[model samples]
Each structure stands twice: as C-alpha cells, then as structure tokens.
Target: MIGNYLEFNVFFDIIGTIAFAISGAILGCKKKMDILGVIVLGLVTALGGGFVRDLVLGINPPNMFQNSTNAIISTVFSVLVFMFFYFRKNFTSRQVLIFMNEFMILSDTIGLASFTITGMTTALSLGLDKKFLLIFVGSITGVGGGMIRDVLAGTIPFIFKEQIYAGACILGSIVFLLTRNFLGDQVSMIICFFTVLIFRLLAVKKNWNLPRISD
Candidate 1:
C-alpha cells in the first residue's frame, strides 16, 4: 500500500534519524558526557525506536544493523555537535546549557514528527492493516529512542512527564490514516509530519500537559 511512497519514507527516515541524533548528542552534552558517550547516546536515540519496532515485527538484525548509512549519519552529526560546543569556548557554561536546552527541544520535536510517519509507513508497507496496531507501532517508532536515551542518561523519560510527546505522534498517525486515501500517500505523509510537528511545538510553547495527580 505504501510502496509508491518509498521516496517519502526514505526522506522522513533520514530527517528523523538526523534530528534524533542531534537531540541525543545535545542531551549528552547537557549530562557532561565524553565524546564517545555523546556518539553512543546519539546512535541509540536515533536508531533505538526502529530497533524496537523491527524486533517486535520480527525483522531479525533490524534495519539499523542491516544498513550502515543511518549509523554513519548519526555518528557524524554527534561528533559535529561535540565539536560545535568544543569550539565555542567563549560561551559560558550557563549559556551553553540554555542553548542546548532550546536546540534539543527543536530537534526532538522534528524527530518525533518525522519518525511517526515513517513508522506508520513501515507498518503499512509490511501489509499491516489494523488501525490500533499502526498507531501503536508508529508511536513506538517516534518516541522509543528518546525513552532509551533518557534512561541511559539517567533521567526520567520526558514522555511521561513533559508536554504531549507520544500523544502528538498518535494524533499524527491518526491523521495520516484518515487522510491517506483522499489526499494520497505523499500528501498525507506531509500533512501527518506537520501535524505532529506543530502539535509538539505548540505543546512546548504553551506548556501543555495531561492531567496528573498532584504531588
């Protein structure tokens, strides 16, 4: 069903990988991890979601291991992030912290949006037809990496505490599934991507949050 949208899938996959890698690298910097740690964190955050998704779908070895392109991309970007901070020696530690916080949010939001669509496309391409399963897989693909990154970084997963994270992905998946037939795959994918992106950004901007028990 999604065969004709292969180009869109690949495009979003790359975008998502790069964005997630950058976000992970930034988090590493915030944690004061070494360069190697930064790269490892970035790789995990960029690929962890797909790793889980493929494993659940029974794809042995997973795409992250099957191909080296995304891995290489993640590594290069992680190193670049490290170097970027390294060379900005004039910036105070507080300044760096502030900048990283803002930039990480932007990259993570983009990654969340892009990967949500890619996850749905992957399920659709593999002939999965159930709506709930598609949304579930897509949300996993969108947020799983960040969850792993946070855990490895010794922080609570933001999706559980921060503004609408996986919820944005679920909504985007629903939008894509709803619009795909009428708008066509490419258009629907674009719409879905932006839907998640905008929703996430707005959540951050407005400090939106689901109800939780008062501490």
Candidate 2:
C-alpha cells in the first residue's frame, strides 16, 4: 500500500514538473526571449521546487540533479514547447498573449498543487512534526517555481502580489495533514491537489486578495 502511494506521488510530481517547464518556456517565448533563455527558464522553473524541497530536507545534491531522467524530461519538454511557440509566432501578438495567459494559469495551478504535496511529504520525511512548518514548506514549494521563472524572465514574482496563490497551497497542506490518517495517502493526496487547484481557480476568477494597508 505504501509503495503504491509513493509511486503515485512520484508520478504526479513528474507530470507537474513537465507542466511547469512547458509553461515557463511558453512564457519566455511570449516575452520574445531567445531559445537558450527559454530553455533556461523552463529548466529552472521545473526543478526549483524539487531543489528547494531537497535543500530543506538536507538531501545532498538534490533529487533534481541526482535523477537524470527528470532533467532530461524537463529539457525535452521545454524545447518542444519553445519550438511550437516559435513556429506559431506569426499569429497576432494579442492572440498569443491570450493563449499564453490561459495556459499559464492552468499549468501553474497543477504545478502548485503537486509541488505543495511533495513539499509536505518532504517535510514529514525530514522529521518536521509541526503543522505550521508543513504549511510553510508547502507554500514555498508551490511558489518557488514561479519565483524562479519570474526572476529569469525579469518580472516581479507572482506570489508577492495580492493574489491568493500561496494561500491555496497552505489550505491544501492543511487538508493533507489533517486528513492523512483518516483518508490514507492516495485519497489524501488527491483531496489536497483538488483543494488547492479549485481554490486557486476561484481566487483568480473572483480576483481575491489579501488585505493591505495603504500608506
């Protein structure tokens, strides 16, 4: 039972990484970055969460570097996305922008959920027993990729904005931690992913924001 759950988690992690890499590549293309720059952005975004997770877990070298398959997959996915966008660049800039925006939102949501769960799992393995730390690690994993992508692309990180981005990750981590014993691993993971994704979508749709004080 435990083996199956672990396999499922790894599967989802790989999918999420690839999705984020594609998203990064697409965004780079939209921003008119060169091919090398696009690939660099994609690689960083795909691996950033895992890198952070490993660092926090005290895993030397990080799984992203140790696991050759993950790196190869990320690179190939990024290249494919870059080529597709390059070929389609003749389309109107407005149309391309719209398409990229839609893709970014969907991909980012999936990546956020996957990385959040993975981060919580890493924290658990690292002997982090506190719920607060789990939530913090999950939020970091969820937003780390976007932060790296934004820095590479020379834009402000999205999580620093007024959006409910990290909030969704925190909610998901809380759900996972609260229900893991009751729901078991697989169901708990699914619940967490769906909770984050749905909340993120609703937040975006409703323009949800954290309260801020004006100077």
Candidate 3:
C-alpha cells in the first residue's frame, strides 16, 4: 500500500531535497551572493521541480506549500550549508575544498535519482500510465529544481551542457514504469533510483556527454 511506503518516500525525498538544496547553496556562494540569496536559491532548487510538476498536473496548491516538512528541511539544510562554507575559510584547507566538491557531486546524484523515481510514481498514481508522460515528468522533476537554480544564478543549466544527467533520469523512468506492474511500486522505485544514480556516476567517471556540434 502507498501508506506503507510513506516513510520510505519521505526519507528519500528529504535526502534528495537536502542534497539539491546544498548544491544550490554552494552555487550561490560561488556566485558571491549574500546569505539571503543563497537561501533563496537553495529553497528554489529544493522545491521548484515539485512545484512545476504539480502545477502542470493541475494539482491546485502544490505539495511544497501544503507540506511544511519539506520547506523546513530545505531551509534548515540550505542555511546550514551556506554557513559552513561561509565560515570554513580560515580553518579549512585544500582538502576540505576537495571534500566539498565531492560531497556536492554525491548529493546532486542522489537528488537526481530520488526525484526521478518519486515523480514517476506520483504520476502513475494520478492515472498517467502513459510512457511518454511518465518519463517526461520524471525527468523534469529530477532536473527542474536545478534548472531553476542555475537560471537564477545566471548560469546555464547542467542539462543544457550535454551532460548525461537527464538522460539517466529518462532511462530510469522508462525502466521504472516497465517494471512496476510486475515488480510492484516500491521495488520499481528502488530499482529506478539506483539505475539513475549508478548511471550518472558512471557517466561522470567516464566523462560521457552528448556530441556537441561546432566550437
């Protein structure tokens, strides 16, 4: 039952949201933005995707507004991340910077994977069993927040750069829908999450990218 997976769903969403929120905060810091600007970017990166997803689905009053838990999670993590980066200059060394970069990548991958599965399953519940819509929504939900953050930060979104990030989402979504009927929703979601996560990690390691046209 959906209720049985409630904790499971919330746990992943929280982890994903926190991850993305920190990514946004880190970007904001890099952009030399103030604390408030970092907070805004972080929250936007955390919830923008779900807002767009719910809005497109015509679900009035998106869950981001209705659910205070995600908002609190986003705000708390965003602020904490910003503060950590802001204060680490004097005491922290080069290793800390390397760790921060690695942590950001790790969290971003988790966010991408978790959101892809969450969005796909949510669409399925709404009776959108179509292949294209499920994949579209799933991919959008995974990357939408990051897109918003990047645009607001005056940079190109990651997906626009020919990275394999969204591609991983699309593939995972398709796999999730295909397996859901036979494997059950929870099982499908778990598989889909790992699919995207592993795929992106592999792509990053291999330096994979879409073929870019001229210079």
Q: Across residues 1-215, which tens digit of lDDT does each residue of candidate 3 receive?
A: 56645666777788889988888887777777889999999899889888888887777889898888887888898889888878876524677767766777778888999888778667766767778888998999999999999999999988988458899999999888788788887888889999999999898888899988877
Selected candidate, larger lDDT, 1 vs 2: 1
Candidate 3's displacement at residue 171, Å, is 0.8
Q: Write the per-residue lDDT of candidate 1 for residues 35-91, one digit (tens) a residue.
A: 999999999999999998998777788999899999999999999998898788764
TM-score of each: 0.97, 0.93, 0.92
Off by over 4 Å in 2: 1-4, 126-128, 213-215
lDDT of each: 0.93, 0.84, 0.84
Query: Which residue ranges in model 3 land beyond 4 Å of their true spot?
Result: 90-96
lDDT of 1: 0.93
Please give the distance, in angstroms, between residue 183's alpha carbon in candidate 3 and its true position after superposition.
1.6
